[model samples]
Target: MALKWVKDNALNLGGSPDHITIFGEGAGAASVGFHMLSPMSRDLFTNAIMQSSSPTSYWAVKGTQETSARVATLAASVSCPVSLGDALLPCLRAVDAKLLTDQQWTLVNRWFDVPIGPIVDGAFLPSHPEDMLKAGDIKKTNVLMGVNLNEGIFWIYSFAANMPLDKEGATDKEQFRNIVLAIADNNATLQTELLKVYSKEFADAQKRRIRILDAASGDSLFKCSVVDFARQYTELGGRVHLYSFEEKLTSNPWPGWMGVLQGYEIEVVFGLPLNNGSTNTQAEKDLTKEVMGLWTSFAKTGTPEFGEVEWPMYSTETEDYVKIRTKGTTVARRLRSHACAVWAGHQFP
Candidate 1:
């Protein structure tokens, strides 16, 4: 309805309905993916740009049973009668909005679990996102999608902050093992595979553990799904230009460990470094301009190609993408092939 309203009023708003470009970052990007797959949203947009997300991402959608359970939990918490079925809506609506928002956090039980998200609704989302993509049921549009180099670091930071830790104030070896087991759902085969795949050669046990967790979390949560989406979409004859955000700015406020964290690209994409009060370096300013140019060019022309950098269309054959950074943008192939292979058929909980 929001997209429809925009299309309906584009002329009065000094925009063109024929050139609508729907773009988003993180969960917003996932929403863009859902729009592409939803029949009701077909013809609503001409192009899309998804940063650090995919419709098929594990946490992007919830099952009907799980969603119902969450709703019941939320209703019960606010003194609403869950057993009343249809009566619950009015009761929930009567509760204070801020109270309900605060209680939603209690629904999250694990590090990567998202209690509230899109579901397989009969209308907006007719089926699983993976099924839709594989069946070629999605609206074909020029798409620019990619993930950050260290997307999982943010999760690691969150886990360390929220989850219980040993006296050393770090995730011990046993704690790390247990987290991996929980992530693998206690499947012995998967546990072994994960340990083998994420093993690091670093001599320091703590450093090795952190790096392994970072890689596993990033791959399972973001990188793999984005790659899989690109492959599936391209297989269906959809044009896609994939990318990897590798730039880490000196002005970043987060700990150095959180390298190229999720949502970091937003500032650069919007040319924030060029702002009047920004402390970003000249190089960052230049990169911001280039990034803004790429984004705007794509929004206007359905292609990100600008200046001397040639971004080849992503495909299963080439698996090509441009690595955005301060040094210089370079073409890299087969992003995380080994890690993606390990996560290929398996769905993370």
Candidate 2:
């Protein structure tokens, strides 16, 4: 769709890249991850960067048929589920502008029911992207994979900002809590399992429990899948570079700790920069230069490096990845191990 949109409307400004890069941030990164492994998307791009995303390695639905059924109703109501035969999608798009203005926050979670998404029909998106990735069917795309620290807290907080927390209505704080609760509730099993894991680390206070849950879920959902993506790519003799984003976070209303919360790099990526105010002045400049070297190199050469140090590809055997932080970048052990362990243990088929 990304390329097609460009093509369909005469976006062939200069024609395709001899090595076009298709990548995304968050779920958008999942699209990049899929492109890395998909035969359909192969010729479209030769390089991929999957930032802060890992497809369904974080959480898998038990009954997508039921989920699809629910989505189909919405699609039918809007005369959506567009295809060559289906003209009603245009009507739905007309409703889209209105829906954007009038739709409830809850509807955002119902994005699956909408026509535009990763379809499970086994046609376009055939299987889980990770499945194809691990089986090593993915194309040879130099890949970038990693997650932002505290990636989930803000997203969960933002998503839950409209819930009717007190029955009468939503206060700002209450709404935020509601979003957190709703998400935690939706993935109750994962939440419950995480609490069990984190209890070993921070054993008291619901706040601490929630924080721990955020960390674990952040790992399992986004972080691990990235590592897994690199693992598969490296297995295929493909080039891969992985990094963990850990720019010290800005101060919060709460007194003590600062944060590197979700999507913060979006502003940075857009060249809109801010300081988290956590580290010293020198550390800040160093880290900025390091990250710039990475992404810019990846963008330009499909290889991320500063000078003599070329970014190494990740291999399950070698178990190495870059730790992107407020200090500088350094290779570390296999990333998101706990996340991989959790998912592997759960889906043992």
Candidate 3:
């Protein structure tokens, strides 16, 4: 409805309906994926840019029974009677909105678990996202999708204050294993496989342990699924420009240990450094221009080809992706191939 409204009134609003490009980050990025897959949203947008999320990500959708269970739990928390069937909606509607919103966090079983998300409603979703992708049931459009180098640090730092870090503020082997177990849902085989994939081989034990945990968390939660989506989409003959946000800005407020954290690309994508009263370095400002140009150019031409670096179309064989950096953008192959293969073996949903 929203997209239709925009399309219907684009000329009246001094915009072109024929040239819409939808883009978002995190959940919003997942939403762009949903729009891409949804029949109701077909022809609403000509291109999409998904950053750090994918519709096929494990947390992006829940099984129907699980979604219903979560809704019942939420309703129970607010004294709404879920057993009342049709009455439940009104009961939930009667509850204070802020109170209902506050109860959502209690539904989380793990740091990465999203209690509320899209479901296979047989209408909007039509089928499982993975199934849809496999059958090529998604809209054929230009796709731009990628993730950050250390996406997991965002989640780790969220609970870091309550976590037990060493004097050097790094994770130990035991702590790292515990984190991998949580990410693997306490499955021993999966945990062992994850540990092997992100092995503790670095000479520095502190950095090794931390990096292991970070890689496990980031790959399981974001990168692998995004890659899977790209591969599936490309196999279906869709144009995809894959990328990795590798730059950690000098003006980054997070600890130096959190390398290229999730959502860090937002600043450059939106030209935050070029804003008034900004203290970003000249290099960052230049990078921001380059990034914004790529995004706008993609929206305008369905290709992010700008400047010296030639961004290649992703394929299952090559799995090429652009590494966006403050120094310069360069093409890289097989982003996390080994780790993604490990995840590919595991069944999601």
- Structural similarity to truth (TM-score) of each candidate: 0.93, 0.71, 0.94
Model 2 residue 69 CA deviation in Å: 2.4
Residue 56, candidate 2: Cα error in Å is 4.0
lDDT of each: 0.85, 0.58, 0.85
Mark the 10 consecutive residues where model 2 has the least summed lDDT. 249-258
- Candidate ordering by lDDT (highest first): 1, 3, 2
Candidate 1, residues 64-111: lDDT per residue as tens digits?
Answer: 888889988988999998774789989999999999999988998767
Q: How close to the true structure is residue 346 of candidate 2, measured as C-alpha lDDT?
A: 51
Which structure among the candidates has the greatest TM-score? 3
- Scanning candidate 3 in windows of ten residues, the lowest lDDT window is 160-169
Query: How many angstroms is residue 227 displaced in model 3 relative to the true structure, after the best TM-score fit?
Result: 0.8
> Which pairs of residues collide in candidate 1?
none
lDDT of 1 at 100: 94
Q: Identify the runs in model 1 with alpha carbons over 4 angstroms from their true place.
A: 162-170, 200-206
